[model samples]
Target: MTEAPPDRRRAGISILSKLLAMLLGVSLLSALVAGIVGYRNGTDSLRAAAIERMIEVRESRAREIEAYMDSLRHTIILDSRGIAAQAIPELHDAFRELDEEPVPASEQAAVRDYYEQTFVPELEGRQGGEADVGALLPTSDAAWHLQASYTAADPDWDVRLATNDAGDGSAWSAANAKYHDFFRETVEQKGYEDILLLDDEGNVVYSAYKGVDLGTNVLTGPHSGGALQDVFEQAERATSVDTMAISDLERYTPSEGRPTLFAASPVGSGGQASGVLVYQVPMDEIDGIMTSGGAWEKTGLGRTGETYLVGPDHLMRSVSRGLLEDPEEYRDQVVANGTPRETADRQVAVTGSVLLQPVESFAVDESLRGRSGTGVSTDYRGHETLGAWMPLDIPGLQWVLVAELDTSEAFEPVRDFTRNLLISVAVLVLLVSLASLLLAQVFVRPVRHLVSGVREVAAGNLDARVAATSRDEFGELAGAFNEMARSLRTKADLLDEQQGEYERLLHTLMPEAVARRYQDGEETIAESHSDVTVVYAEIVGLDDLTRDMSSDEELETVNLLVRGFDEAAERLGVEKVRTLRSGYLASCGLVVPRVDSARRSVEFVREMQRVVAAFDAQHDAALRLRAGLDTGTVTSGLVGRQNVVYDLWGDAVNLAFSLPRANDRPGVFVSAAVHDRLRDQYSFREAGTVESGTGGSSTGPEPVWELEEDSRG
Candidate 1:
């Protein structure tokens, strides 16, 4: 407590000041070190979480797109089956007849003006250049008339599909009137932009939307080298109902240069392809899925986040969210990012970015190489973003899906943490610990829930679902995972349905035992039975009865009679092998040997006669039933790979088929072998002889016996 000298007092004060300075330095250093480490770790974790979220979104979107494409394919294929069998021949004849019908000069001028004035101007507006109207003009008088009726007649583009007739009394117009609404309804209901039907010669016989491509030959038209033509050619070569073709997204001039994708399938029945059915896929459906209906935030794609598709040419196939939400900003960014100002302007003018924006980056390159994962790269807008990319599994199109989020938004939390830690040095440790705990709750817990749900689903529990406990990216991921599982369940059920259909089809084609052998991968399926009996029956006078009927009426009548025969055969325990145009071949004891195979064959023949008699009586027509039965050793087997058929062959089968032809009269006939077995149960009389058509047979003519009037027991 004593006062010291001035110099000693100043030295003591200096030492005290030095001690305070050292303490301040250590505090500042600790705060600085803590902020740097926290910021680094937080940013890394945030980036990883963002990338994982993007990957989830990318995979979900890819699956949706593939499912959509597959649905479209199935729709086209199912519609193509038997669609053109009768329509093609009728349209082809009508188209030919139109050639003989002259078109007035006024009609010709109208069609030309439609292409030169209405179509070309709109096309040039979208394409930013002139189009050759002459190349798109119809070259044939038939084409000219049809186009005048369908394309040029309707001045309103919206109502073009509703105009079935153009007041031109032409055969082509009549046919169009008959089928226009059906095709138009298909387009509207299925969300297709357009539907085109082409004849076997590649003539565009029908167009639902009446575009400029209608009435022109796709094989050799001006648009012949484009994607539509390629799909058409590929579809025309398809010989089965399941075979189809698809084209990449391209700007279709006929659609006013809009980005369009095309799918095609052959249209016919009976194992023959007679025409091609083409569908123009709407671009909006694809864009809607990629953009999530413009509610990106709801889908957990925060502001500046988007999903898009890139084709093999590296051009965008879906619309950009920036272009949709804010065109000016998108245009400016793209222009600044090396895109030509004119191109950016065009994208903005069209209100779309498809086919105009190019995404050249590591993500795209890797996706095109068939790799899938997440990474850091520059996006199409030239902003640094965390991206997830994968090749789409859609068939026949080489495309990729990319999900991206700008780094500024993804690292925003990290920045906030750093800023707060720097602002309040006293609370540095508390802030770091809080941020770490928050991040773990936000990302790790949700990820664990998702992993558990995924494991459950993978273990065959499709009903497993993760709780969408919050409105965050993790919640969105949970929803997407649930949707994927639901899709899988739906697909599994669909597979089961298809498997059942395949089984039914197989059984319809061959016996159950033979089908089992075929399913087991047997190369050759044949069975020999010595005691089998075959009954070959023909509906006599059917052709004469159906001579005056329309093709549809004839088919209906034949189907009705055949169905009745089938029901009767099933009731009598007879196996139906096959049915020809007017004949049915059935057998008994071939699959399960029976001592009364001859009796069963005779019973089947009697039942078939009853079916024909009922039909004749109902239609007030004169028709007869002729059938023959035989008992002998026979060989039964399936033939062909793609178009499979079941048949039996032997002396017995040959005699059963030939005996009905040999007897000029209409009745039930039996060979001697069958008569020998059934004579005790059924009364029989000698009807005559059936000489083998192969006349050099060493065995003489076989005797044929006719059943008595009261044959049924």
Candidate 2:
């Protein structure tokens, strides 16, 4: 037992451990798989959201870019042929001479002197507010698109030629000062880089952000190869002054070679073409729109997301996100795109800051060809990136908007989600494992207790009882086990009592030896005995007394008298064989022969007479009792099925009953066979022999005798 407990506990623990392990293993595996799948799904969802955000940013920038261009075009037309389009005669003559290509050096020197002495002073002398300058303002009917060449073909290109050198009070000076503020304030409020008015011959008549551009003919100047030729040619062919034309994106040396677009519209007065209004709209304004919406923040693109426009030539038209926030990364990105590192640094310095240098990527290439879609690909910086691209809907501008970001930055939220998911799954699995182990221990306790109790019962210890620890199946099992043990004990007691009763009944029914023979499975019960005494005793008036008595009283009186006889017979060493209707039949030495069998029968008969006489006296009634005895060869046997009787048979039993006569009194009457056997042991009165009559089964008459106890004894 010392070793058994440890071994059994180990076995129990091992079983519980295995069960817990299986359950937890399956649960954790399922949870892990589900978590991984959920993580992947969540990641994909974030990616989709990022791409959708990129598309929105791209669309928003496109709209703002279009709006910015429209504002510049509108401002250009309002000012042209109006405030800054005055073609003074002296100004026209001066511009005409200066517009000559490859003129004499002296002629160019004279034109420069004229601009320093006349144009510079008159242009700076404008003063005060001019609220009623409407008369000076040209009507919309003024024709600006009728001129043919890069010459002073219309007066609107003429700048007011300075003459008197009187300073700040002249009409030209007043108008110069008044509209100077107009151009400057337009640039401030409307975000145009420059607003220029050109003559019909494409001469720069007036300039905002005034530089060398004023008083020069753009067709023959350093910027001649730019959109000036196209604008003049288109204006020459226009049928109305409202005719507008736009040039493709390009760099103009007049604007320091930054990317620019020229939108030119003709100014008109009374349907006569007078001048062309050109809005020197810089691409930088579009760049500002591209960066307006905080796309990275709204779209969850975080650090590296950008929205930019690209021309049909596949060059970026807008700035990059990294250029603004992370110039170092932007430098590396542009250097990788064929820019010399020193050149990138020089260019960034020359621009007074870094810029998203132009570089074509997969998205740019696709958008340039009018294709539109979204995907993951290497970006302009050669990093794996996600992007969405679509063409802009503005007319005459084959431009596209693209939104892009590095994949790592775009899917940043997904990464964080996955990390948290991993931590949560690990913790949950741990908790489940621990919980399973504890539950296993709790569950196994009841089973172990039950096993121990069953083992005790197997070892025959019925007292070994299991404690019902909980209201569960184990408790029910313990209760059932206790009931089984009790039932076994009760059955054992019942078996012992039943066995005792069986033996007693068997003994009461027959002699011990005969009963033993029956218990041994003997089918027939019979025995032959020589000189066995058979006696029949009767209550003399039992039938007559029963007629006068109630049923229960008659039965009780008979029972009392019969029981007294049986007691006396038992005391005299005789067996009471059968009793019927107050008649008692007894045998002496029927099972085993005895020399005193007849004498014992005579004593039993004397006892029966005394018992009957005493019963009559005790009850205060005269009840006759008689006995007849015969001593002869008799056969004894058991009869009946449900209840059996042991009695003497053959001649001896018949002669005993025949010995009684109708005239006989209440005394023992015996056949001569009994007198012959018991006359010496006790005295008897000899009676005359009687012939066999209807009352007897005997073949011949037998002498009878009256029985008495021996007085000498």
How does each model score on lDDT?
0.84, 0.66
**Candidate 1 C-alpha lDDT tens digits along 327-413:** 999998988888889989999999988889988888999999999988878987899988889999888999999998898887677
Error of 2 at 207 (Å): 2.1
* Per-model TM-score versus the true fold: 0.56, 0.50
Candidate closest to the true structure, highest TM-score:
1
Count residue pairs with overlapping backbones in model 2: 21
lDDT (C-alpha) at residue 336 in model 1: 86
Shift of residue 311 alpha carbon in model 2, Å: 2.2
* Candidate 1: stretches off by over 4 Å: 1-41, 82-85, 424-713
**Model 2 stretches with alpha carbons more than 4 Å out:** 1-14, 78-181, 293-301, 352-356, 447-713
Error of 1 at 597 (Å): 72
List model 2 lDDT by residue over 1-713, tens digit each.
36534443433448787889888989898987999799889988998898887777677766787786676556666666576455322234434543443344443444445444543343333211222222211111111110111111212222322111114233433344545566666666766666666766666655555444555566665346667567766765778765567777775544444556777777657777666777766666675678764455664456777777767666666666766676676778778877668755744543422232555677777877778889988876778888888888766678888878788887788889988898989898998989899988877674677778778878877677777776778678878878887776778679889989999998887788888888898767887888778888777777776788888998898788778877887788888777798677788877656788877777677677677778778877778777777777778787776677776687778767767772366677877776666566667776666655434344665677876544322
Deviation of model 1 at 456, angstroms: 61
Looking at model 2, residue 549 earns an lDDT score of 88
